[model samples]
Target: MQRIISFLCISIFLISCNKEKTDGFLINGNLDNVKNNSLVQLFRAEGRQTVIIDSTRINEKTFTLKGKIENPDMYFLTIEGIKGSLPLIVENETIDLTVYTDSIFASNIKGGKENNYFNDYQEFIKKIRTRSNHLTEEFKLAQQKQDTSKISSLRKEYEVMMEENDANDLNFMTKNNDAVLSGLILERALSTNKLEFTKIKEIYANFDEVVKNTRAGKVIAEYITANANTAIGSVAPNFSGPNPEGKTIALNDIKGKITIIDFWAAWCGPCRKENPNVVKVYEKYHSKGLEIIGVSLDGTPQQKDAKQAWKDAIEKDKLTWHHVSNLQYFNDPIAKQFNINSIPATYLIDAEGKIIAKNLRGAALENKIAELLN
Candidate 1:
């Protein structure tokens, strides 16, 4: 159960398509059960960012918020009273959101395309549950019979079903959708909700032109273009900043060498923990022209504590490489340009300044460098 919850959490992060809406849905609940001073938040997605548009409270177990939103995206009906939330897709139509402690129910307060979407989503859920059960049964049978060949065959069959499921889902959104923004929104929502980031990337890669040619094509096009440009295999965007010694150094200046750009912070425990593997790689590959560039997202350089934390880490880990920092934290120009919101993000750029691979660590990191440098 814990593993399942963890997987769901990962999927939620991957597929969160909270889009900003001009209007919010109507929420109905028993407020007496909720603790005082608790708040409920409404969320939406704008381009690559998720925005919280409105928040309200429940009085005596009943409260309603009414507003219209511009774009369609995922909305959550959250209760500060409890730890769980309900996933909602808010559109131009009015919706009646019903909530409980652990489960939620919603209805179309206003009818039309939005209503159809909810109905379709319900069906999608049903199908997914059925498919998941079927896969579980097949796996159990294969294991009980000790049939290795059958297990492989069952796995292939399960994969084919998942593809069919994706196709069915896409068809549902494209067929009935008249609004250009609607399709893009649906695609983003489903991709995120279904934990299908790879599919999201593929959609941007293959159907970019189609998305562009559509009514809201420009908005969708810009998003896809920006994402694809920063994706693996493209040239890493160039920038320059002051190194630890307060000297100017630029990515372009390091041309004709394999460069690993690591966006990290001293406060980020994962980044500090991963430093040893990075040191090992640097020591092994430095002779072969491998360069490690550390971009720190610590606060102001005036904050001696933050700066010293990094300095101490370097000394302890023996991370002898090219380290630099603007000391702007997430607001650092390079991080913003790269759209990096999380720490411990990594990129491996080739001699030509083109990004080759990314987010490698441990054995995978070692194997990749060994393959390329050796």
Candidate 2:
């Protein structure tokens, strides 16, 4: 009887062990041509920062990383001396990855369903990039030959291809709303500055609660909320800063005019290039109730002479307009309030301070101002 009881207990213990749930992730990775015992690092993106969570040494071209995660998040697996890093969604499941030196970006990742979906999205983006490169090369050739007809046709084709890509990406995100990858797709769409605020809001609303609650999803949601205030038909957020002469100028002070709130930096090449066009528009329309407030995102701890740089750029570019900067570089509160992640950003506000358009450049800017002022 005693022997039989012991046997029953052992059987129950084995069964329980077999049925035990795994609460953490196990990433089993293999890197071809990687030296044995080489250092490998894992990084997780929190907000705009990439934080290293763990590191391990590859043994015989293989390494394993284990960690607990509350939800799916973006992570990078990097090998020492490797030129590229492998990005994957880390979830609470076993992930099998194979990285090759020659094709690190195309490394094979299996296991987590989120990773699978991410891999698919990456493949689609790769194909799009390849086609875009081909189209660009053709465009250069057409330009060299001065073939206006070919250039027009190629430009139309490129635009259509890009539109189709965007549509497909949106569809994929909609269908996979439960996956973290969907949130990432939406974030990319926001960054493109092409999608309308209403459309972005619609997409965000369609996302599943699980996706919306992820770190990336939270960030996207916040961005959408921030953008809503500055979006077309919405009231532009008011701000105040010191102009070049060290006098405080508020957006409210410039109310009752067609205003272009231009966010730029002296060091930004694109901003510098676009200045002449801005200058042309300002000169043409300043007399017709068109006003511009140039906000400079120049100034860093290393550059104590940022104020001078801002003044010089304005002088050199011939931008004779109300210019302001806190000389806080990227840490400018106005930039943060407006969610100005990129330079060369503009908000066209009407007499009532409602944003009428955004990111208008060159001919677009001129045409819009012409329509409003005339």
Candidate 3:
């Protein structure tokens, strides 16, 4: 069973041929158990940012919110004290909801294209989660009973389930190419190393012009462009940043026959933990035409002395290699160019500057270097 649970919503964009309505959406909600005077809020999520769009207090076990949105996007409906937030796409239309306080996600939502998609996705996830939950129980029993055959069988079953889940996600993204939700899905796929650039580019190419014009579409379009240069088989994008001494270092200047571009920061726990492994790799391989550039994302508004922290970490960790940082945290130009949202990220390139691999760590990082240089 796939352990990841991603909520999805799909809706057909409803357009009126005769009259265009500038008026916004009306949400009519009913609380099943009658919790009166409680606050309800709506939040709009764009990329990693979120803002509340509308909010109201329930009266007589009911509530209403009216608002207009420039584009259709994902929105979360939360009632004060509700255990879970109800996710539904919000568009410029009348939306109806029957909230089940005990099971918020099970609440019926309809009346808009966004609601249609939300319900469809809910039904789809219901089946997937049900089977996955059952598998979890059986696997637990197998482990307790020391049933080796059953354990292996369940592992295989889980792997198959994961593949199917991935395929289903891709299918939805492909079939709903014209909807803003498709762009959102594609944007998520772009964030990870799961799909290759070719696949991503292919999907982006198929999106309708209208989809491309939406906010989500524009964001994904930017992601696609940034990833193209860093994707395996493409040349690594060269970047420059200020070293600890106020001197500058550029990727093209120090890139050896084999190179590793390591993005990390001092505040990052995982990055610090992985530092020793990276140090080990560098020590063993530096003499054999392997080089690494440590790009420190250390400067945040909260840090008292970002530069001192960067220098201190290099010395404390014994990171003896080319290191540079704009001290701009994740906003570092190099980090932005590479679309790096997480730390301990890396890219391995050959002498010609073509990216050969990415995000390798520990023994895998060493093994890949050995394969090329040794």
> Which candidate ranks first by TM-score, i.e. highest?
3
Model 2, residue 166: distance off in Å is 3.0
- Ten-residue region with minimum lDDT total, candidate 2: 10-19
Q: What is the C-alpha lDDT of each candidate?
A: 0.63, 0.78, 0.78
- Runs in model 2 deviating more than 4 A are 1-26, 44-50, 66-71, 119-164, 240-250, 253-259, 273-292, 299-308, 314-323, 326-333, 336-343, 348-352, 356-374
Two-way TM-score contest, 2 vs 3, winner: 3
Candidate 1, residue 205: Cα displacement in angstroms equals 8.8
C-alpha lDDT (0 to 100) for residue 369 of candidate 3: 92
Per-residue lDDT of model 1, residues 120-191, tens digit only: 555655565567677778889889999999999877877776666556656654554443334444444432
Q: What TM-score fits each model?
A: 0.59, 0.70, 0.77
lDDT of 2 by residue, 117-179 (tens): 655666566666667778878989999999999999988887787777777777887788777
Error at 297, model 3, angstroms? 5.1
Rank candidates, TM-score, best first: 3, 2, 1
Clashing pairs in 3: 1-158, 10-117
What's the true lDDT of residue 338 in model 2? 84
